[model samples]
Structures are given as structure tokens and as C-alpha cells.
Target: MNKTFYSALNKSTVVLLFLAMTVSGILKAQKLPLPPRANDAISGSTFKNQIDTLSVEDSENQIYQEILNGNIPTFLRDLVPISFSKTIKDSAYVVTYFVLPDYLAVGSDTDYFLMPMTPILAQKIAKAIDFTLPTKQMVDQIWSNASVKLAPSPIPPSAQMTTIPVMWEHNTRLKGKRKETLKQAPLGALVAGHKKDVIISNKIYEKSSKPVVIYGWHYQNGTPIQPVYAGHSETYADYSHGIRLVQDSVLVNNKVHLISKVLQDIQKSSLFSGEGVIEKPFYPVDKIE
Candidate 1:
């Protein structure tokens, strides 16, 4: 009887030890932390190469969509991918526009490069991101979205140069020497979709000899449609009038070739999402239809 009792006691001790070991292993596994970050930026040439090799058969293809879906390691939260149909240089180009975050949404207003500047000054700011005002079609594409709304100038009320009515009146007519008509474009128009109050088209023309005109959006009034801001005969300098930057896009061998030096710069500036959606929220990439 004593031998049987000792044997049972030893077996019970072994079972408990085995259970403890199993529990310990699970606890250790659960406590493991995330891996270290490389934080490397994708170069411009590398970006172009990726786009070239991408098997973009259509909207359903996963290649270009992968980049749009954040498969790329370094991506900006504020950079929205957009494709709008437009005719450029006598050829059709469905270029992608990666929108910079609204000036208000980038943590603080002062953190960004361009706050308020004339169109000429805005071009200088565009240099920081290695972008420029692309073909007129690119501007029209950005304004194509329904979420697109008007942003009023941030200038103080005292600096009033052109009233909304006069600006609209001037833009509604046929081509003329627009230099005299434009007073000042308030600071609001400089940034895209700064306000949702008004909806307007963003296409502006500033050819040296041609009449400057802004293809305006119709605002709801008693009945008639109105216009938005455009350049003038003299320099139309105001804190409100601004310009947009577009990275170069071209069709090579019938494939979309785009170079975004802006994204790389944003990463270097530490304004990127390594894997977290913490800062600079943006819209999804629109399907090419």
C-alpha cells in the first residue's frame, strides 16, 4: 500500500510541472514586442521604376492599387490619390494627384511651407516639394470631386480688395484684359478645399499675352450662377490667391509614369505614417473610370 501511494504522488507532481511549463511559454510569447523600424525613404528613381513594372491592366489590377492601399512603406496620410480625365498637350492623360493635407489638418498651420502667398510666391513654395502647376487638366481633375468646396481667404476683413460679387461678375464675361478686373484674391483661395461653404472650379489661366480667366463654378443665388477668382492685368497679389503643385506625370510605352519627389520629402520631414494612422488623414484613391 505504501509503494502504490508514493508512485501516485510522483505522477501527480510530474503532471503539474508540465502544465506550468506550457503556461509559461504562452505568457512569454504574448509579451513579445514589435520589431525595430528601418525608416528608409523611397527615392524618385525607385518610385518611377516601381510604377513602370506595375502591371496596371485596369482598376482591378493589384499592382498600382497596392501603392494606393498603403503597401508602400513610406506614405503620407494627407496625400490623397486621385485620377481625373482631362486633355493635355493634345493627348489624354489621366494623371494622379496626391493632395497635400489641408493646411489646417497638418497638426498646426505654421508647420507647413506655404501659408498665404501670391501665385508667383506660391510657385516658390512649390519648389520645396519638387512639383509645379501641371497641365490645365490636372487642375481641373482636382476640382472634379464632389467633396471639393470653396475656401474663403484668411485675410483680415480690412484688406478687402475685391468683393465676391465683383469677382464673379468679371469672371462670367468673355475673354478680355483681366489685369484690370481682378482686385485681390483673398487668402482663402490659395489652399485647396479650405472651406466647405462654397463650391467652385479651380482652373486658372495666366498666359502672358492671353486674357487671364478662371473657369468658375456656379454658386446658388436667387437664380443666376456666379464665378470665382482669376488673375488680372496688373499683379494680383493677395494673401488669399494661391497655386497648387502637381508632380510630373507622362505616358511612357502606354504606361502611366509618375514621379513624386513630394512623398520622399514628406518622409524626410518626418511627416509620414510608418505604420500608424496617427497624423494627416486623407481620402482614398479614386478608381480610373
Candidate 2:
């Protein structure tokens, strides 16, 4: 073979090998395990049985029906039987703890009236205990029973800000000099990138404010598609341009920290999807009766 031809062939072989390795690494990465599910050992039968026992009384049946219809008035779902390995006196309260996926903590502890629990309060208890909810239906039940009432005092104007709308789209990259549209990317590739971007954007927003509500809804061109996940939201207050909130589907326990980290990552990468909002401040006098 001519020396020039031999050299060209060697370069071509090296390029092909590099491409093969690169492709292999991407495939491996794409094979990452699915996100973990909430782990509650109580069987569905056992949960039903317990509910049945509690519903023996007529009054209890009313409560059970209320819960089933998503009308549990208290934030704490009906308490499952809890056993403490060791009891402590002067504890002020004894409550069952529920751990949410992504590490969120929910407590069934309530005041004397047993009003529904607030997500903010549940977050406080989750800092200490890792408990699991037996079922998602329980969460829905609690939310339904819980009523939203006017604040005891008017909320400060600064605190009453409305959230900005957020949107998510699949990430697309060109392949082999072909400019591929986002719609053309493999589903897995698009999802992975979108998830990472959400994580990144969330961290950037957390530096300023904690998001009170975080839920996932799909969108195309600012229209709802379908809801995917429900979780907490976080915000960044310090940005000079109006307030920005970054939201994501995070494990309950991992919410606060994960949000902060994701936002910071976005700042570092300077990759923002333009999906977020600044809340409008509410005046306490106007809000309160």
C-alpha cells in the first residue's frame, strides 16, 4: 500500500474505534436503574384489614368514607397503629411518621381539633424521622380532608407571591453532522437530559425561597399535556431580575438539598430552559378580613 494511503487508513480505524467506545458509554449510561419507589412494607391486605378494624364503629365509618373521598380534614392521615421500641415521657406529642419518596416526611400529628396537616409542617418533622406512607391514596385522603382556611393573620404581602408558570421540553442534540430535531431523539435520551436540566434549574432557584408546592404537568407551547409527578418546589430570591422559581420531581426527603444543588448546577452550566416565575407579593391588609 502507498504510505499516504496506509496512514489515512490507520487514522480512519482510530476514529471508528473512538466512535464505538463513545457509543458504548452512552448506552451504558442510558441503562441506569429506574428511580426507586416508596417502600412501605405493610401489605395492601393488611392496610385494608387495619382500616376495617378501625371502621367497626359507625362514627369511624363516616371518617373512613370521608378519607376515601379525599376529604380527610386533617393533614395527618388516619394514624396507623404505631409502636415505640422505647417510650419517652414529656414528649409533648406522639405521632406516626410517613416517609415520602425522595425523602419527604409526613406526620400524622395534629392539634386538639385535628385539622388537616400542611406540607410545610410535614417537612419540619421529616428532618428527623424517615417514615413511609402505606399508599398514595392516603395522601390524597389527607389532602381532601384538609381544608384551606384564611390565615389567622393576614399573610404579609411579600409572602403572598404567585408562582411563575413552568414548562419542560425534551433535549435534542445533533448526531453525526445531522441536525436532529428534539422530537427525533430517542425517548430515553430526551427524558434523561430533561431530568438533569430540571435538577440543575431547581438548585439555582433554591437559594432564595422554599417552594411551597411542587407538582409536575407536561406542556407543549404552554399548554398542559399530562401530569407526571407531584412533589415540592424551590426558588432563588437573590437574582437581580425578578424572582425565579425552579421546580422538580424530587424524593420527599431529598427536596430541600436537591433543589439547591440543581439550581447551583444550572448557574454553573448557564443552562436555563426559561421555565419559571416570580411570585406577586400580596398585601396583608388586602388579603385579611
Candidate 3:
């Protein structure tokens, strides 16, 4: 080959190699692993057969017939899953009595029903049931009780500014109407159920130019005497420019008060630990969505 041609080919090869490396790096950054599959144990053919059997049984139900005939809202019909509990065969018949746009009924022992919806749909169904049942007062009572334990103490007049990260308190207890306490030294607050929603709504109200970090404590179950609190923190990125919340889960409670107001009161100390600017630079508007 001519020397000039050879040299040109070598140069081209180097450019190609660099392009390949850049492309590989981009792919690695973008790829996200999928969640585990639910039906991993079943063979594809066996699963198909099970679904066919369930479909046949579903077709025989009078209520299912009504749904197919369009008596119910299509969204409900499409969203509700068919669930069968072998322990309560008669309960299946009762589900049909509600005349809900979507429900399940079992006729055979081998039948299995799986809801074709996501967790969000389950929440919607729960909300719908709450609305029909009118249980807002009960929910409010629980939240109010929870809030009493979580409310923050008044910031001292002397303290001009503070910077705190989002924090959480796990395994806390709801004590008397006025207060809640932790079992150990690092006591945390009992967060209100609506606090997360309130924080997000406030960010929009303020037209915040910077990110808003919200610290919350999550309680799963158990009596107030020995409750569990998991420190949960989320950051809402700049919303004024249209970016939404960018959540980050920090394990450390750098500032104890950031997690709970009650904890701060007990210790008589600053809410955050290592900090630069504590108070939000701008106060959010009182109104929220």
C-alpha cells in the first residue's frame, strides 16, 4: 500500500476505536435492570394453560358477563384484577353482590386470579372504597395522633439560619395526645401521614429556584409503645424551571431535628449537625396544591 494511504487508514482506525468506547460508556450509564419476574417457576406453556382455565371460569360468572356487556365503567373493568382465596369460597360470591364494575368469582378449586393492575391501581381502589365508605374522619384521627408526635419545636429567636439534610426516625412511639418519645437516646419524631404531600406542595407554592430537601420518618406497624421509624429523605429539584423531585435516601441523621421535632425538644439542641445554610433561603408560600 502507498505510505499516505496506510497512514490514513491507521488514523481512521483510532477514531473508530474511540467512538466505540464512548458508545459503550453511554450504554452502561443508560441501562437499568428489570425487576424480578413473578412467574419464574412456571413453564411458559403451563402458565398459558392456567390462564386459559381461569378465563373459562371467569366467562361463566354472571357478574363478569355484566362487565363484558358494558354495564360498568370500562376503566374499572380493565383495571381490577381477579383474585381468588381458596379459604373463602363463599366470599367470592359476595364480591359479585357489590356490582362493582370489576371483581372476581371462583367456581373451581384450581382457579387462580391475579390482578392485572399495578400498586397505584390498588391505591386508587382503596381510595374509592374509602370514598364510598366515608372513612375520612378515621384517617384524620390517625394522622392527627401521628402528627402530635412529629411536630417540630419552635426555632429559637437567636438562631438566625441553619442548613439541614432530609432525615427520618424509625421505631418511634406515639405516647399521650401531646407528645411521642423514642425508646433510646437518638430519639426521632413521628411524622404525620400528610407531611410528604405537604412538603411537595409547598415547593411548588414557593416557586423555589433551588432544590427542596424533605426529611420524613416512616412507620410500618406495631403498637405505639415500641414503634419503628426509618429515616426517609427526598429532595425536590428545581421546580420553577419544571424539574421535579430528585429523591435521595441518606442513612445518617446528621441533624436529628430534621427527622423529628419531638427529638429536638428532648435534647435541647440544633436540628442539623454539620451544616452551611440551614433555613431554606426562601420561605414557601403557605398555600399548596
The candidate that achieves the highest lDDT relative to the unseen native structure: 1
lDDT of 3 by residue, 1-289 (tens): 4678667777778677666665444323221111222332332223324334332223223222321233322212211111111222232211000112212111111221212211122222323232111112212223343412343222222222111111101111111212322342111122233122112222222333422323222233311221211122122211010111111111122211112221123231121112212233122322120
Q: Lowest summed-lDDT stretch of 10 residues in model 1?
A: 104-113
Which lDDT tens digits does candidate 2 get at residues 1-289?
Answer: 4688667777779677666665444323121121222243232223333433332233233332333333311212222221112222432322222211111111111101111112222222222222211112222222222222111111123431221111000101111111233244321121110110111122223434434322221122222121222233331211001101112211221112222232234231111112332121110111111
**Can you give the TM-score per candidate against the true fold?**
0.34, 0.21, 0.17
Could you tell me which 10 consecutive residues in candidate 3 have the lowest summed lDDT?
238-247
Give the candidates in order of TM-score, highest first.
Answer: 1, 2, 3
In candidate 2, stretches whose alpha carbon ends up further than 4 angstroms from where it belongs are 1-12, 24-29, 34-199, 202-206, 209-215, 219-222, 225-272, 275-289
The Cα error of candidate 2 at residue 178, in Å, is 36
- Candidate 1 C-alpha lDDT tens digits along 1-289: 4677567778778677666665444323121011221234333223333433333332124322332233322212234445444443465544344543222111111112112222333333334334443322333444554242442323333433233322222222211211222243322222233222111112232234222222223232211121333334222322233334343332222243333232233322111212212121111122222
What is the TM-score of candidate 3?
0.17
Q: Which candidate is the best by TM-score?
A: 1
Runs off by more than 4 Å, candidate 1: 1-77, 85-94, 101-114, 134-136, 146-235, 250-289
